[model samples]
Target: MTTNILFCGDASMTDGVLIATLSLMKQTRHPLHIFILTATLTVNGHHYRPFAAGTAERMTKLMQTQNSAHQLTRIDITDLFVADLPRANMKTMFTPYCMLRLFSDLVPELPDRVLYLDTDVVCRRPFDTFYNQSMAGVDIAGVLDHYGKWWFHHRLAWFDYLNSGVLLMSLAHIREDGLLVRCRQLVRHRWLFMPDQSALNIKAKFKRILPRKYNEQHQLKPDTVFQHFTTFFRFWPYFRIVTVKPWQIQAVHQQLGLHEYDDLLKDYRQLAPKLKEVS
Candidate 1:
């Protein structure tokens, strides 16, 4: 069966996306139907570049090399973005690209069920078990945020706040319940710490909490399937936030003290240079 995956980011996310793709390909031999959502926007005079067509073409070729049925499609949603602009949170620390996944329901090309992955995550094991899990009545399935679950509970004291980074979305259910529509409305009017993520937690009615292995945000464990390089808080030396992505090779080795993806990084180093020349 073809595994459908979705990613949303701007042009700057190319390196991370490439590295994430390589790591995922290494884990699974199934045909991957990858979709990247991007848009060119000018908010407050700062320009956001969309993924280049040439870059998409190059990535497509790379995927085909793994499996002939594997495909990468870049979809620009500039018009849709302008229609439902996140006015309240556009200027926040998070980039406008972070909100693109909110528009996925409106995009006709997306499959009914798709696994949405943040560009910063690296797949360490096959995800077919998680991807193929039944989503009969659930609008979305995700792992609880390592930090947000403790603080961002909406109504009940029990933590249900999920990280938006790795979401197994049931687009059909979302469309039926108008979950994305409500999320967009919430983000447009109210500004939250993490707008898109918070909106999802607040609006999604039926959500399934998966095991931490699906989105291991902290230190990698033996059972971790997707190692998410999310931000961490360090309070010992000085109060600071640490952010590390898979593409940052040196940081992965020295800062994180993790050498799990060294072979992948070596391959990335050899292949990444070609992305610049693609266009």
Candidate 2:
């Protein structure tokens, strides 16, 4: 059986998306049918940049050379729900790309189930571990958001708020129950800071919760299957905190001893040029 995987990102995030894709393909045991959600800058002043030409072709060539079953498909459904996106409580860190997962229903030919992952995560274990596991009867399966759990539990009174970074979606269930529509309604009516994630959590509060190892963050563990570089903020080993990403220039590297990850990104840096800016 083919494992359907989904990812969302834009020009600025090209590096993360490529690294994440290559890393996953390196570990997945099953054949992969990958779907990429993207957007163009529709509104004046809207910041989204279109995917570089030949992006999908390059990805497919890279994956197919390794395994014929690896396929890459890119779809842009920005116009489907662009107006429905929330604004009042939207977080500055979020862009239209963050809301792409909400429009999964409109993606014409998605499989019955698809695993959605943030571009920031790198795969270290066979994806079958996640794909093979049953979703039971839930619309979504995801790891609890350790970063936002307390706020969700205390403020929102939700017991099962999930990290949207790594999720297994039951597309059939989502369509059958009109879950995405309900999620959109929740986004419009509720006070949400992380709009898409909060809407999913509040609408599907009973979603299946996976083990922490599935979406492990920052530090790696022996059993961690996915190393999620979820945070861009780097705290000093002893004192101060700074913001840095592994792919950025060394001017931001902290002495916090995370060079191991920076070096990992360097190994895949050769592929970065494929995502060059439109300018």
Candidate 3:
């Protein structure tokens, strides 16, 4: 009865996914069945070996200490019927991976419910509490979007918009309510900064809204279970504003004031320091 966690990404986001997973593993002792939806592997198998062997070994050690274990599963995109999913031509960072999450119900051998996370998030505390909790009556549970006021649809107050980065989805409710079909319909007609995210928000907008602890974005708050890297640029402690990614070398030389997040990414750096170093 291991907890199931899902992530969707291609080569461009593999490392981010790896780091995010390691961060979660670091905080929790509960066994996890990590499901990754990806199509192509990195150019060489090189990027994957270290994460599979080295980082996985670390997880094994931690799990052993806690009397738990974990497994990794990769679901190929080509195996799914996603060839015709509607995608907006907006120049956002949207990718095919974004659309794969909509087909959560189609995932073979999946559990009744699962947690979905974006590659940019880092888990700070144990979430098996929320993961194992019942959704009550909602099909999906998520935190309210901090930037919801900027979204055109959210301004209408149709429903409280939520950031799609972290979601606790109840497959039973989704299938029962025809959520997939509705989400597909919304995706086909609407264009948002994040198409898939916007579609999910529009469809599940009235569902249960989780506490702020579940998905803290950009700003770190007390009792935060998840810390998200929504903003890449910041001017703090430094005289001038600068952009820095913890995964990038700039973090070490520039005073981006993000060292607070070092613990979240330590395993990632030690195991695979370079971009695409882990797939």
Candidate 4:
């Protein structure tokens, strides 16, 4: 069933978020209208530089491979780069947040009630039910914030900040309220506080917050649909995350058949095997 659209941004390079977004897209039960754009910048008045055209192409290939289930195709939605959005440019640091800010501003072109998900989130269920809701009255719907550190809480105007990593955004409010500007103000001030999450807090003071189950990822998740891999997301979700931190260079080196901790060589060797087998 073709349902309300759910959009997320993508970069030229396929980072952890792109991989996670594709994984979650595969898990969507109904036919999904997912939008993927890049937050590229215009260096000068004449030059156009995207986050990574090659990387975006690679991400397209990866998404196309799952065509049987998700069947997503790459398309260029806009030429607006990260720098053109005026005060909303704070989103460049936390890429996904900026992408959503773009979505909010451009909701007139988007489906009525769509879910704007971040790349770090993994889906455990079909997101159809979340789409068919009426967000006209409700402002925003996202997971409850997960305080990464003690100092994180103090940075916000209030303690209740929803996680923007995964959430349902209402296209109508995005165009009307002009919340993105306020949210960007927070981001520009390094009110970057919790990165993108802090910007959502700035919006949440006036915008409504979604329940916690949508992006649940801490401890035991009995009723969560997605898991936001914050700083503590060191292990794979479904895979039995072995007693190893994925960031551990030694562990990564051994897995990639690397002779040493060579950043350039390790990335190629590590990801090459996985892509080869899958391809």
| Per-model CA lDDT versus the true structure | 0.91, 0.73, 0.67, 0.51
For candidate 2, lDDT tens digit of each residue in 10-114? Answer: 767777777787777778767888888887754436666755547777878878878998898888766765667654434445675777788887677788899
Question: What clash pairs does model 3 have?
Answer: none
Clashing pairs in 2: none
On lDDT, the stronger of 2 and 3 is 2
RMSD of each: 1.2, 3.1, 5.0, 8.2
TM-score of each: 0.97, 0.86, 0.78, 0.61
Cα distance off (Å), candidate 2, residue 87: 4.6
Off by over 4 Å in 4: 1-18, 42-103, 107-109, 148-159, 185-191, 233-279
Clashes of 3: 0
For model 4 the TM-score comes to 0.61
* Ranking 1 against 4 by TM-score, winner: 1
In candidate 4, list every pair of residues with a backbone clash. 12-52, 12-55, 12-56
The better-scoring model by lDDT among 3 and 4 is 3
Deviation of model 2 at 209, angstroms: 0.9
Off by over 4 Å in 3: 40-68, 79-81, 87-93, 150-159, 232-246, 252-255, 273-279
TM-score of 1: 0.97
Mark the regions of model 1 whose C-alpha exceeds 4 Å error after superposition: 237-239, 277-279
At residue 123, give the lDDT of candidate 2.
81
